[model samples]
Target chain A: MAKILIVDDDEDFVSAVNLLLKSNGFDVAIANSRQEGMEIFDKDNPDLVLLDVMMDEPDDGFVMAQSLKKKAKNIPILMLTNVGQVTGMDFDKDSEMVPVDDFEQKPIMPNILLEKINQLLGK
Target chain B: MQIIDRQKVNEQIRDLKKKYGDDRSALMPILQDLQEIYEYLPDVVMQETAHSLGIHPVEVEGVASFYSFLRTKEKQGKYVIRLCRTISCDLAGKSNVARQLENEMGIKFGETTKDGKFTLEYTNCLGMCDRGPALMINDRLFAKVDPEKASQIIADCRRDFLKSDFPKVVPSDVKKAGPILDHDLKPAEAIKKALSMSRSEIINTIRESGLKGRGGAGFPTAVKWQLAGAAKGKNKYVVCNADEGEPGTFKDRMLLYEHTDFLLDGMTIGAYAIGASKGFIYLRGEYLYMKKYLEEALENRRSEHLLGKNILGKDGFNFDIRIRMGAGAYVCGEETALIESLEGYRGEPRNRPPFPVDTGFQGNPTIVNNVETFIDSALIIVKGSEWFNIHGTEKSKGMKIFSISGDCERPGIYEFPFGIKVSELLKEVGGEDTKAVQIGGASGHCISQKDFNRTIAFEDIGSGGSIIVFGPDTDMLQVARNFLEFFVEESCGQCTPCRDGNPKLLGGIEMLENGRCSFTYLNELKKLCETIQNASKCGLGQSSPNAFLSIVDNFKPEILGRVPEAD
Candidate 1:
């Protein structure tokens, strides 16, 4: 089973995702901020990362994603964002400035997200 | 601790301390060097820096987080594409440029590409307003870039990345016109003239010319010199504030480039007038290309007896200047923050009870004048106050250098007398089919067609010479939002009003843009901006809302496109 790191400030969302991933037989770890996320990422060396666009600040998640990509170039990342709703600017996943394999907007569909995770992890 | 070589890091830190001096003030430069070495400020490096500076780790961390340039992350890409998203560039269709880059590189504004080849990010301004839409790939600037050019630029970067050969892309040719003072004049001519006059006479000439600091704030140059000269201190210093970080303003760059010796001569003259032996030119980091030229000028001056050890061969008038580069902070352009950055601290603005004239650069009496101000002083001394005063209005005397860009046939530098109307300038710069004009970069006023009759004087509509004309199709609300986002990222976060208030204003602007804000909410935001203007610690915070307020005041109908619901 491939291990995945979920780095987000949304506790309820993280718990829900954690339960879903675990039920699907994937190893899961969680971090609430960029610093904490990096620490866990270093420790676990997760095969994939689920990053949020806004954490402590609006661009914190993006900054964190860049750092993570630097550390592990091949580790695929799926970005979580409500940027379109917040700023009325839609972020295209394929044309994102930050390096992210996919984007899952908030109020995520469990099946779609699982499919994306599987696609990114090459499972 | 484990990531870096301990001995090597210690040696580099030691070298930095020795070079910048052993004082705690060297902290900013030291941190900048460490960041250059490590790509970002790691926790271990911060701790070591604190230990080296003999300060607490929190202080180091606090300073590191305060500056926009200093990053604490480890994820910088090979080519960081800093696209200028300020008003001038925005009006010049920077959005299209951004979209093209995003589509080509497969990344959004803040994301690095998958191959670590590119990291697209938005920058406040690269001082190339006359060449917008401008973007910098690393420190190499690419100006006048359209959507097609942006794609080619990115492709060029990818090619360079693959080949490991990164050469600076030559900036597109910017046409120069109008009455630029002393463009072809020799270096030490003004200084020689000033050397013949009494110190008081030089100050009086500047006063008679009615010259003011051209760094946005129209404080009288003569009065500033008088204060510094009269201040009770033996170790007086003259600091030429070459840190021209104002968005859309690059007249200083032109001045420094074309007339390097003229600016240095002016600084030397300032040192003599103020009875100061030491002088420093705080150059901005973005214009690193100008550094070598300036250093070469300084070297020539030293050899010619125009700078060091009794400049111009006069005893008791010894003076010299040294260049100190800024490590990319917009707030450092503020006088107090510049002083703080000079002293090696985070470029945070200090409270103004003891102004820089009284307590500056090592707590000595110092005179901090802008690059244009120094050049104006030199010209005033040589040309006589009466001759210099003949050009401008009653209050705002002397010619001003304007960096005109966007929505024009010919965009570049133009020098005009202060009382010249906006329409007149528009004609000169080919500003046709104009809807609005943003004067003085992000933190200056936005004027509409009705205000074209307004004169460019301190008494009417003053500026630091950044005029960005927008055609009819340009969106005023989007322009305002672009400036607000600039303030959001560049705010030093020292005070509550600025730190918290700017982001709120940005959010409010977004809400309004999306038609989610009510009239009452807009009014509240206006009130909040007033508070921020009055209560913020420094000029950055105080003037941050100028464009927003001006846009709202002028284009209320546009901003209120949606009708307000009754409570």
Candidate 2:
């Protein structure tokens, strides 16, 4: 089972994600802030990172994703953004995407999230 | 005060080299100190700069003269007032504002006051279009100002300068004083000089003066002239890249208006420099006034025997300039695309190697330069290399003109020494509440508070002068996305990456707008943006992603979203 690190500000969400991954028979680590996420990433050396769009800081997720990629070039970064008009998602294209591996909208359905992660990791 | 000779200036440069380590690194700052001491960079100053920098003086000259912000010639003024006349400011009524300043100061746009208190000029957008009606007194900015307010500001500056015991001889306005072509010369005189000059002499004069192409690439003007001349074409042509496609840059338009003859003269001179008999100006279709001005000026020049064959009773050098208006296509600004547009094809960039200097325009040699670059040639010929060499540092030989716009107390075009500190520029032009300044125009980079220390020089900033300021409330992400939207709409749909990639990136912004995008989708958008920047074939495709990168890097939260905890 590949170990995954999920970085977000919400503790409850991290726990829920951990439980969901554990039931799927995968090793999972959680970080609640960018600093903690970086530490966890260094310690666990996870195969992938599921990053939240907004944390304690705005765009903290993008910054964390950049940091993660800088640390490990091959490790895929799957970003998590909130869904709805309030966040404005209509402007993105496949070409304009950052150097990140993949992205998923919030209100994450388990099947879609799993599919995206699997596809990114080429599992 | 003595006009410092070349050897003495070189010694000062040498001392500065010991004080500051890398001469190339110290290029702008050294020029700044030199300009402070000498008011403008003379040819000797350039020689000194090269000696101090341990590089070819031509390199220093190239960098200095390419930018519009640096001033090299002498001016009889205590103050230089630059007004923003770019499209955005035009929409915001800059003409009236400029006229007001002219009337109140009792000096035309390039003329110093009889009392030697002020010189006035108008320039393109300085990037603060959102605030509109911008003006610069040296490096200081005043934005959202009306005619009356501008009058008050100028009056106050003059009064303050006059009263001060420690008056800096060049007026507090020297920092804002760019090349003032405020002189009114007959259109025929301007055309006659350009028509009479020999190709090699023209090239050599420009070479000695160290002028660089102003159309984004910063190529040496003299080298391009030489190449185009030697291209062995039976029918060679010269082109003025007046398709001013950059979003926030409007210096060319100002050049078209204030010095109409100056530009035509430069083109004629360029034609002579490159051994070309025919010339075309591919002006952006949007500049209705510029088209009218050039057409009338061309007519006037023709009437005076300056444009026709063997005019000056010599070996019959025949040349004429015509205007070809563009139909709202941004890509036409690119050299190859411009050639394509002129040839009645879709404006798309052609691969290089057989550059336009050789195989261009109907399979003949062609040379293209921005309007400002060509205008400087007239001054270069009139003044000589020694005159052009004085204003900027060793690397950048002459003055650069910048269009200042955006949220500031006052904003407009500013001409100054090449190496003036960003902080000093902000202090000079940006009002007290200034937050950030965008260098290079809308498509240019957004310099945040952190990068304020970076000097505004050719080596650091990529292209010609355009400084746009922003205040506390400015939405950087929105501003950047707006820039992207411009690209999306303007893309000619010639290439897949530019056509498809532009819309896709724009779609990401849409997702952000709807607020429906998950953080994951936004991340995907970021990934795609990188591909566009790295993979695109043309400048539009490459730079289209710049605003997105700046937004993603600098204003992340605005584009990304927050997620609630799973309850």
**Which candidate's lDDT is highest?**
1
Error at B407, model 2, angstroms:
0.9
Candidate 2 CAPRI-style tier: incorrect
Please report the TM-score between candidate 2 and the true structure: 0.56
Off by over 4 Å in 2: A1-123, B1-175, B180-198, B513-526, B556-567
lDDT of 1 by residue, A1-123 (tens): 899999999899999999999999999999999889999999999999999876765545655665676678789999987654654333444322345788777878999899999999887
CA error at residue B560 for candidate 1, angstroms: 2.1
DockQ for all candidate structures vs. native = 0.01, 0.01
Q: Which candidate is the best by TM-score?
A: 1
Error of 1 at B261 (Å): 1.0
Which lDDT tens digits does candidate 2 get at residues B255-289?
A: 67666777877787777666678888887644533
Model 1 chain B worst lDDT window (10 residues): B162-171
